[model samples]
Target: MKILGFRGNVDPASYTLSDALPNFGRASGDRSHAHSGSTAKGRDGADVPIAPLVTIAIPTFNRAELVEKCVRSAMAQTYPKLEILVSDNASTDGTVEMLRAIDDDRLRILTSEENIGAIGNFNKCIDEARGDYFVLAADDNYYRPDFVSKCVRLIEDEPGLPIVIAAYDVLVVDEFSKDDRRTVPARLSKKLSTGIWQGTDILQEYLHGRISAQLLSSLVRTDILRRNGGYSPHPCASDEATWIPLLMEGRAGFVDEPCATYMVLRESLTEGFTADKRLGDLREVLDELSAVTAKKVSDPAMRERIQQLLNRYLAYMAAVNLVIYRRGGASLSQAVQKLWGWRTVLAKCSVTDFLSTWRLRSIVRILSPQPLARWMAKNGFDQWV
Candidate 1:
């Protein structure tokens, strides 16, 4: 893995995990910048350390209007110590000017003359973060004031906890500009325990290809992430691909309360089933994950569960790619090619015909292009995806 700065480029693979962590970890303080630690007042200049310092990383690309509110939400956290890092991935919008207007001493900006792409930006933020804990804040999402505090508590107290997933409500905003908001409880399943994301215990829940699997809705231990080499610099579902395996750090934990709001936007990745152009990068990352699991984890049952998870995810990717192609943005041939790629990979990893039948209809619809997909949705198969 290579760690590229806004301008400086450094290769991470050259350094051992021990060396990688402390150098970046020095950035993990309650202080936002090297100078002005004392006068860099938060909201009321009050001081509190109940929560560990969390590096709030917002990776933005032209979404200046919504990004500001997202940054402000991070600033409003009741958790006192926060190091806000805004990574502008070559945004042409007035994001730079907007960031400058904030003028909060606690805020720092990292700019790039070239667009290193989304995953690269995400990796850079993780490599550069200066907090005991880290959050992948969306440019359009709003977090509750207690989000950081609650996450820190879980990470600090839980002995083996690696990542802490938070419960959040999903909001569907009006189609106009970025401001009009319509809120509803994000229909997260009770069966899908937050524990699945916590890394505390193995979740029998299907691991592979579950789109709901995410890192943005969770806060992670920086040390653990660094040890694992941070987020995979991949396309599309790298967050899911990397996070599912990392959850093995401990049983997943949850506050059992909604404290954050995930904004659903048309431009957001979740909005469509389109495969990322960097899907190949994600495939490499998953391949690495399976290799790591075989080496690090010893239990057969756990390994089996992980394999099942990967298999399911691969199938889902194929189905989603079909939808994207149907939507007329990408070519059908490319989607089919990726589907075949996933099938070949998972076949080697042990996805049996029996277990693969779990979502057979959905997979078949992608391959055959039947109207049965609509029928499945009517029959509650949409949730199966």
Candidate 2:
């Protein structure tokens, strides 16, 4: 009976949403005549099949304002069969109160007794999901209406594919302009022109430091996820660093349409987690991933790609530490620590590649980006970088 209002409309529930929302009734009608059961309307007012029950699982800890928009986005999906699950990590805020007031039967709220960390909360969401496929919806980001439907079609069409990655628009909500949005379509061009990378092209790209897209861009197959032992337990890039290798089991397909929007936060772990001591944690995880991928994958090509990716990550880590030193985030002593640690990994890699990255970084530091980009372009280091 309590149909709360969202951002834009309380004017009139369009015919489709009106029927879908629980206990729908006209403003003037008798209060007793509310429609309760699921009845989805098509574009021309015909009833289409209700979508397969989709569980959009969100892991939350505070950020009440952001979670509301995320829930609204899930509710707005054109697909009829959706169940929104919010797994709260025991926040002291009024997050629970805010959710309790929402009158939708489709939305389910799950909570932890105490504050579990984000990784624990996420794993709980996965364990609780009943949908044939599970979508990891972050508290801070949201999806377009077609997200579920498009992904469902992709997975169903090629049921064997372990992951269906939809193109997503990166929304740098804080500082970046809308013009700065990047598209993350699976690149066939890279597959061909780059030649067969490591073992699998996906692994190769990941090894090459190219799999930096947001987690929201991916809708993972539940079975494949479970088989791989879920989220990475050791506290470093768990969302991304874990999922990329799991998806590497088979080819990753990309949908052309933008399904989700990632709202970049200044304090987002992907950015700040690489600071201070956390960088060491991330480096350890990357190292573990490299070792595991190499041992597990049967294909020699994949192992090579995984090793190359590990090498590239070592190089990137060195570059990042150098930047930290230049920007005063790290002391000369800390920079020395990083250089000593990472240079060892670099030493294991091909000398040409190591020298190329070192030369490129020095060039960038000396000259402006324009000249650096031009010079790198002149050499083939542009693509490798």
List per-prediction Cα lDDT, in the order shown. Answer: 0.55, 0.53
Question: TM-score of model 1 relative to the true fold?
Answer: 0.68
**lDDT (tens digit, per residue) of candidate 2 on 24-100:** 11112111211233434422243322333567888788878889899999988886667688988787788989998
lDDT of 2: 0.53
- Model 1 over residues 1-385: C-alpha lDDT tens digits? 1111100000100110100111122123232422223222222232322345678899888989888998998899887778888989788989989999997877888888977766667767877787756787767667899977777666445433556666566564542345755444443444554333434232333242222224556777666676776665443445555565656554555554566766654333123223434334445655776776676557887776666655554444434444534333334566667556555444543445325533654454454433554354334454445
Give Cα distance to truth, residue 164, candidate 2, Å: 1.3
Q: What is the C-alpha RMSD of each candidate to the true structure, in Å?
A: 9.7, 13.1
TM-score per model over all chains: 0.68, 0.67
